[model samples]
Target: MTGGVRDKDRDAARDDTLRRFLLPIGAVIGLAIVVFGTAFLYDKNGAENLLAGIYQLLGNNAGATALRNGGGDQFVAKLVLAAMALLVGVGGVWLLYTGVSAVVGLLSLRKQQRIIPWVFVLPAITLLGIYLVYPTIATIYQSFTHGNNGAALANPLANYATLGTQDFPHVILNNVIWLVVATSGSVGLGLLIAGLVDRVKREALAKTFIFLPLAISLVGASVIWQFVYAYRPPGAPQYGLFNAIYTAAGGQPLDWVHTQPINTYLLIVIMVWLQTGFSMVILSAAIKGVSTEVVEAARLDGANERQLFFRVIVPMIKGSIITVATTVAIAVLKIFDIVYVMTGGRSGTDVIANRMYDEVFQFNQPGIGAALAVILLIAVLPVMYINLRNLRHQGVGA
Candidate 1:
């Protein structure tokens, strides 16, 4: 009789725990369902009204088609709408977190503690699978298919075979040139600048000016440099800065974009200019983190400034340097804006990304574009693997 009474008490405890957990969850879910159902029933015109407002603000009535694409006129309205949307989004997110936390807290009684983390992470995992995994698989499937439509190619590997062609060789060569020059040039220049300017008066001012380019959009930077590299006929007034300087020095006005290897180098220079500040800032922080006592010991051991820098400082900050170089290299590999805006991939200045764009859109060869994209992904995988390993090591060491 006593054992039977104990079993009944245990059953009662489990039921109580389950009830406590489910009550809050059921309440929140019920509230959410009612809110969504009401919104769907009442706010049927929300999307249409929002789009109409946007259209009106874009001057659809006046038919300013030319000015509509310019964006300067509609900037204020777009900015206001964007700000309002952002505020609403933030408020919604906060409310969601509060609701989820309250529900989870009430439900996290007894033996359900292990499941709470998975409950919180389930939404993020679902989003990642939907956005990232699905697209990658789809892209890979499209690589071997014919054109934009879902038909098999005559030969399964025909698109891959295009990588061996003459034009693709030039494209690969240009990417390599950019990868080597821009990555090294940017990191080297950034390191030198960082080392020289560390602890100097007005250091923040110098760093800010260097980092100013990072604030500019890539397309904007390309546009700014186009005027610098502009070319005209010799007799025509040389309006381009480079051409003007050349003419002043009694040199012929050369079309920088139409030139072969020189044009490729010039484009790489622009990338280097844009990325150097990034490298400098990262490396400077790493340099400053080096132990001062280690530096003092090295100096006491008769190490000169050059020896200290090369032997001590560089070794200490080697990880940051690698990180900076890899980042710049990836940017070089995927560079499209500079080439697209400045040269349109003309005159043997085509990189893989630019060629992929041309193949996909200009020539309507989606298979070839997908093939190029897969190849780029394959190329980046090893670099990414190395970076991840380094990060893991850093984490463990810390």
Candidate 2:
């Protein structure tokens, strides 16, 4: 009877391991079949056909014509399908893994502990991969192909070469101006405002006023500024607020949008105005979080207000400052709405994002747009990696 019991135990362990391996494999196969059947029922080309059929069912024949004339509704449909596929694919894979893990947990307590966390966290990780990873790969690929027909470019490097044109220098220059001024100015102003308001009687009211600009969307803010900078071609009653004031003060009614480097600076001011509030709020929180005991100790050691702010408070809140700066920098890199709405990238006001837009849609040079986008990505990745590293060091998300 003892020998019989030992044999039965061995058989049970073997069956558990087999189930652990087979369950996930079978689940994946089953999911594929379900997704495939869903697509196949719509059309023989699976998901692609299903997407087209769905578009047709919605009375969108524009896609059929636009596909041949370049990307249009069909391109949009495919993009939607791609996103859906990413979500579905990720969910299916996780479900397979989770199901297998849960079944195996029935035999092992350690596996049970592992299975629960995986089930909870898997959805978030999958969505992250779907949104961040897939678009990045697709954009990189699209950079090398023709925008119109998706044909291989005559030279794979041609798109990148176009970005090096004579006009591109102005674009690069404007972007650099925006990066330096907008990022630094916003952070500095934010820090200053936060420090000043900390000891004020009506601190909440002051902060609310300074932070109001950030509440406005970039496009909306641009529209607001448009009235301020509007011109009436000098001596036509000066309709624009800025021009009116300038003419009254005996200054010329300048065409702010058409002016080269000046227009860029003007655009940067809008960004700084919007971002300063965000930085101030964040820095103010960090300031409040600084240890009062340490601050008093510094004061006792003969530190004045200026010295304390510079030497003590600044050092302690450096991480928050960097975080705020990096966030603003990313916004600067991808800035489009203000430039697009205000100047439409005309004159010398064209930044990288606006140029990319003009290349893809306006100029029908998708490859160049893709290349520009890739360049923007390359510039941003290092900053993001540094930001992530800083956050990790600060024990954020720990």
Candidate 3:
């Protein structure tokens, strides 16, 4: 009789605990549903980024300092819309903050107080808002402006008017060609070096030599390569490496940075030289991380060295290879220092970043620059997505 009474008491306690858990879970689910539905409605109208709002505020003129003539409807509508967005923008942020706070409390229940997690997270949150979020919002606002000089930005498609011209497509193709040829070549060489030095007795020494270029800042690397490609009109004692080689071969030293398509390739050489070391180091580390037991077992079999490397090693470190490749690709995509230092976006070496720089700094066109920056970000997004997916897969496997 006593044992039966104890069993009944335990069952009642379990039921009460389950009931308590379900109530909070249900409330959380309801809150999630509401938040998601609101987000869907807001995101549908291409309402992302602050540029559109700033454009609306400026009445379709870039930095006119006033609404364009007869742009009141646009302004009034935007101002009204801004007023409406307040509930979503500000209120949503507050709700998110509250939700995160509650989650922190839940997670830190074992600790002294739930507020400790917030204290730890506060620095990160502050940095994100200031460095990451604020800059992103500011960049968007800059996009709606006409120029740095605060000229009235009228919507004659001045930023995108380049699409109608031939050179615009050429700029795009030049950038594409750079991404493909330069990035692929660099990564390929890096892989070759990494594989060659993976098990070498002087692995550290090899890595140090390969990674030497990474120590140089982008500007410093560019300056060094500028000297390598430096031309002295064929009779200036052949100070540059290329010129010296040319003179040594009984040929006139060519002005490499001034030459057309050749200058593009020359700049590419600098990028490759600088980045090859980085790729080699990362890929070498990945290669070393391969299971030694598996490698030894493969060696004990009748597998030749070639078969062992490609058949066993490559497959295992495929994710690392891809990570390094895509990382180099993104680096090549954002390249500006070399072209900027060497030719200043001239001589047919205008990649997207350099072109964006030209648009904003030289041409004084902010909208076009913003558009270019947005496009660059879009271009790099795929590689970033691939990297994230690869990392998640690795984490799950581990």
Candidate 4:
């Protein structure tokens, strides 16, 4: 009787393990079949048919015009079908896994057991794998290849070559100039503005005026600058603000874009103007958080206004100051908007991101673009890591 009972218990344990594994797998496979059948039934005029219309609209650039109409549509349809099959198949698998996990969690709950919500987040995990991880891997892979395997594509290392050359090295330096001039100027000017408006009666009104530029988008700022740089024929009336001023002063109008280094700095000014308000607001809050009692004590100790501000107020608010600086620094590092909108990485203003864009899109060198992207990622990671660490140290927490 004892031997029989032990054998039965062992069999029961095996059954439980089998059930845990098989149900989820079966569920996913079933879901995939259903999804695939449904998609085939619904998508009659699939990717091929869509691409045929797009090709005609695109004019003569279609490489496989002979393969268009029925033939091209057929090929594209097969590709789409394959993709749909894959997604549906994986989704089904995940669905099954989720169902199984859910059942297990429910059973455990009945027995007064614990289940983490992280386990139930299978769907999010699947999406992250698809959208984030897959793209990053693909990008790295393509970046290793020499321009889509070097068949009828632009030079793979063209962008990097351009970037590495003396001329292109200047672009990196130009970006550095932008970072130093724009980020520091914005923050410093913002700090000054915050100090000025710290305790004024009409501080709100003053702040509103200073912060007005923050409302403008990078494109809008560029357009405004464009108008300022606008020129006309010598005999014609000047529509550009700067040109009009030049004519008024008996001087010739300048082509701003043609001017190196200076034009780049001018573009940086627009970013500084827009970003200063953001810096000011954060720093202003930090300033407000400084203890009033400390300021009073400093004054009592015969410290002058400037001494009290520098010696006492600054040290107390260092955390907030660092937060604002790091925020601006990150913004500076990722700044493609101003560069893209204003000059399109032209006239000695091309930065790493713009260079990457030129490589990937214009030159069709996806591999080099990926490499540059990785380089950029490496550059920003340190700054971001420190910033996050400081933020958490300030009691923001993990």
Please tell me which predicted candidate would have the highest TM-score against the true structure.
1
CA RMSD of all predictions: 8.1, 8.9, 15.0, 10.6
Per-candidate clashes come to: 0, 0, 2, 2
Q: How many clashing residue pairs are found in candidate 1?
A: 0
- Weakest lDDT window of 10 consecutive positions for candidate 2: 40-49
TM-score of each: 0.77, 0.68, 0.64, 0.65
Record all residue pairs in model 3 with backbone atoms less than 3 Å apart, i.e. clashing.
61-153, 62-153
Candidate 1 global CA lDDT score: 0.79
Runs in model 4 deviating more than 4 A are 1-116, 137-142, 148-163, 233-235, 246-250, 302-304, 387-398
| Candidate 1 Cα deviation (angstroms), residue 56 | 16
Clashing pairs in 1: none
lDDT of 4 by residue, 254-297 (tens): 77765775788778888888999998988888888888888889
Residues 1-398 of candidate 3: C-alpha lDDT, one tens digit per residue: 99999999999989767545654564465457447646644754323223345666668654332334323345554554575467556665555555544444445356627576665678579989999788767776666655445475676455666544746677777778778887888888898888888757978897888789888888898889889878887567878998898889999889988988888888888888889998888877887899899999999997888888889988898887887878888888888888788888777777778888887777776777876786787897786687689789889645
lDDT for each residue of candidate 1 in 1-398, tens digit (9 for 90 to 100): 99999999999999877656765665576556446534533554433344445667877744344234443345554454455455445554455555565566665365348657676787689899999889788888888776544457887788888788868888888888888999999999999888877859999999998888988888988888888999998899999999999899999999987787799898887888899999999999998999999999999999998898889999999988988898888888899999998889988888999989998888888888898889888979999798689789889655
**TM-score of model number 2:** 0.68
lDDT string for model 2 (1-398, tens) is: 99999999999988878677777676666567547644654552344555655667788777644543545555565575666666556665666565555455555677678677776677679888899889788888888766454667877677777778869877887888889999999999999999999989999999999999988999999999998899887648888888888788888889987886688888888999999999999999999999999899999999999999999999999999988998898988899999999989887788899988988888777787888889889988898787689799999889
Q: Against the correct fold, how does model 3 do in TM-score?
A: 0.64
Candidate closer to the true structure by TM-score (higher is better), 1 or 4? 1
Residue 263 of model 2 has an lDDT of: 85
lDDT (C-alpha, whole model) for all candidates: 0.79, 0.82, 0.74, 0.73
Model 3 whole-model lDDT (C-alpha atoms): 0.74
